[model samples]
Target: MQETPFCLRVGHLLPYSMLDSNITNFTKTSTFILLGIPGLEAAHVWISIPFCTMYAIAILGNFTILFIVKREPSLHGPMYYFLCMLAITDLVLSTSILPKMLAIFWFNSREIDFSACLTQMYFIHCFSAMESGIFVAMAFDRYVAICDPLRHSITLTNPVVAKIGLAVVLRGIMLILPYPLLARRWPYCRTSIIPHSYCEHIALVKLACTDIRISSYYSLSVAFFVIGLDVVFITMSYTQILRAIFSLPTKDARLKALGTCSSHLCVILAFYIPTLFSSLLHRFGHNVPLHLHILIANMYLLVPPMLNPIIYGMRTKQICNRLLWLVTRKGT
Candidate 1:
């Protein structure tokens, strides 16, 4: 009958129309696919080997620093307290990224849910900013030790150091918390696949459907005002330290005063310089290769955590001897 054919056409068309709507809706609520290290699909297995090795080194090194500082009664000073906090922050920062990265490379498990990605981005940036603050605090510690050695003990007592640590943690959380929350309100109507290994602030913002001008401006503001403020204070602190060091009567005295800060200065340089280079390039360099940007980003998070312990071990006589003693004692 003619009625039978007409009814069949309407029924068939109905599901097709629904299917189109469903597909449109799916993109709005989908998980973000993280593309780990672009153009490295064929070599992912090989590349993960070094990443795994470096992660192992970072973990072992930072844990050892924590243990050495905690067990030794004599090491319970403001400087060592700051170092312990740094080690812990490094642990958190490195763990937040590397495990997920390994999973992506080794198992091809790269689908990160929206909330998880936002959480990861928050912690990564928070700890990074916290580390900068800790460095500034460390610079202040060094300045007090060198410039006002006579009153250093009275000035940076246990309570004072505890307050500094609290301030650093609070500062980072307060400054970075708004970033992800601001980003989350926008709908990501574009492809959900992220081009980087991990969910970084700017990288995630790029995938948004709305205008990211405010996000971009706010991010730059945080960098210049929060991180930049730390850098400026550090420079000023060191300026005073240098002035005090030069006024010392003997060559030996000046050398000794300045030498104490040399290790911390090196760590700061190692952290900021490469990271700054990569971030500037990512934001401004339109033609930079994807793989290169990814590599530098990885290094920025990794190298300092891996190297901080090694640098401190070599430069801080007390720590080096303690570690050496532990090793030899274990061998015996």
Candidate 2:
């Protein structure tokens, strides 16, 4: 009898990334294949049930936030406007991959078309960039509200905030669009498989036959400029906000100021800390076990959506009250 296939004999234990670099080298195939949810077997109930439930929760949680903000007139402000944008971005981010991911997890299909994969990658980056931008914007809102209360409304007018929102979308599109296009231009090798659930820049580049140093450098540079700068601005904004609040005369006013900022700060911490942590873990701890790395990776991606609504509900009393009323009314 002929020897078994090398892939089969190995029981597919090697990282799918081994095939990625090979695939990037191929001249004939323009598209790539993704091997999703690494170890989830068809018979595995533990993974499927929980994964499905998490996706459902993410959608419902974000949708409820969207509804609460849209329905309540009191929630209309630059801060809440950014909150709504954040909610929308969360919805887009989770929905972009979860349905397809669920299909693969529940069923056994892993075939994603080239164009579709690129589209998914684009929106994933788009919303992620938008979220980063809005976080920065939220910091500014907080800064004005705390540091320059008299001019807060004037500084963050509805029109001005709207323009900021539009600019963020356009800039995100500009920043990320070139990546997927550049990705497509490079001919993929015939036999590569993406190990991750989504088309991450590093994961994709690892498979490239050509030197992806330029692409890697470009991605890192953009990430540093975008995410790093946002973090700096947010930190600075909050530092000023804290200083202003402490200097206030009334305990009640100071408490209120801190409370107003608390929720945004929670969401910001949840979003940024995990992101920075995961980056460090990936870069410095590659020798660690795959399961541990994947856990951190998923947390970095998924926790923001889970915590966003919680932050909104806790920090913005109007939102919490309205959401409670809505739920109670629906039940009635």
Candidate 3:
């Protein structure tokens, strides 16, 4: 029979005064539990409500971008093609995690099985890497359009763009494949309660009974490879773009080039900054509150996807006008 804690059964065990006294003398260690949102019960029905709303907005916004690109013949170009890929990535990225997150929140039980957790981790990392890769491709496309406008169409032709898209998908798959395999190999002899909401590789690795040195090294290496290298490449692309823009003889051409790039740059910054902060907090902020970590994680997932379409819509006059025209015609 399992021994019960004195506080939990004090009145019922009062008949055994000696045992009760012994139990009262014992000290317990307090471990952290994922209580989800504070001030709410463990199974609060409204816990999932906020995520559901965000998920809906993300879906609607990205779908609108997709529709605008498809419907407007004038928007057919290498830049818009890259934007479409980004919208598609955002849709897949949000869909991969939000449904399960919502289910746990609404049901008041944030329970996920081992297999499901690993799968979630895999898709999350995969899409995140893919987004990074696609951002690099977008920057390159912009560079070609502005720095080599006459050759832009010939350079980023349909076949070439399709190959670049394939490269992004392949790179994402290669980068994230190791994490799940390494996780599965670990002998999980410790407690299974994941302190965070999702199955993050670092968070889950912290629970493994096996030596995590290899896993940690690999995870950090991949983070540096994807995040660090991609940032450097993006910076280089923009530097060349700036140099080329300044060399332009006409002000109108300069403004047009800058305008084309402004939206993409805004979305890239929105996605990358939060992602870098989240990765840093996850790795180094072990002493921070669980809720703070959870908040950062949500921002990392939702902000990029949410802001992507908004950035494109507000900045791209062509896309904005097409959307407006569609709505106006519908009203008429």
Best by TM-score: 1
For 90-184, candidate 1 gives per-residue lDDT tens digits of 99999999999999999999899888998999999999999999999999999999988899999999999999999999999999998888888
lDDT of each: 0.85, 0.75, 0.78
Per-residue C-alpha lDDT of model 3 across residues 1-332, encoded as one tens digit per residue: 56653322111222244334322211122121232443334544665666777788889889999999998889888788888999999998898777766655665566666777778889899989999999999999999888888998899998999999999999999989999889877765444555556677777766666698988999889999998999999999999999999888999988988998999899988999999888888767767665667768877897788889988998999999999999999999
Model 2 local distance difference test score: 0.75
Deviation in angstroms for 206 in model 1? 1.3
lDDT of 2 by residue, 107-134 (tens): 6567676677778888877788889999
User: Which model is ahead, 1 or 2, in terms of TM-score?
Assistant: 1
The 10 consecutive residues of candidate 2 with the worst lDDT sum are 3-12
Please say which candidate is ahead in lDDT: 1 or 3. 1
Ordered by TM-score, highest first, the candidates read 1, 2, 3
Error of 1 at 259 (Å): 2.3
Give the CA lDDT, 0 to 100, for residue 48 in model 2: 56
Model 3 TM-score on a 0 to 1 scale: 0.86
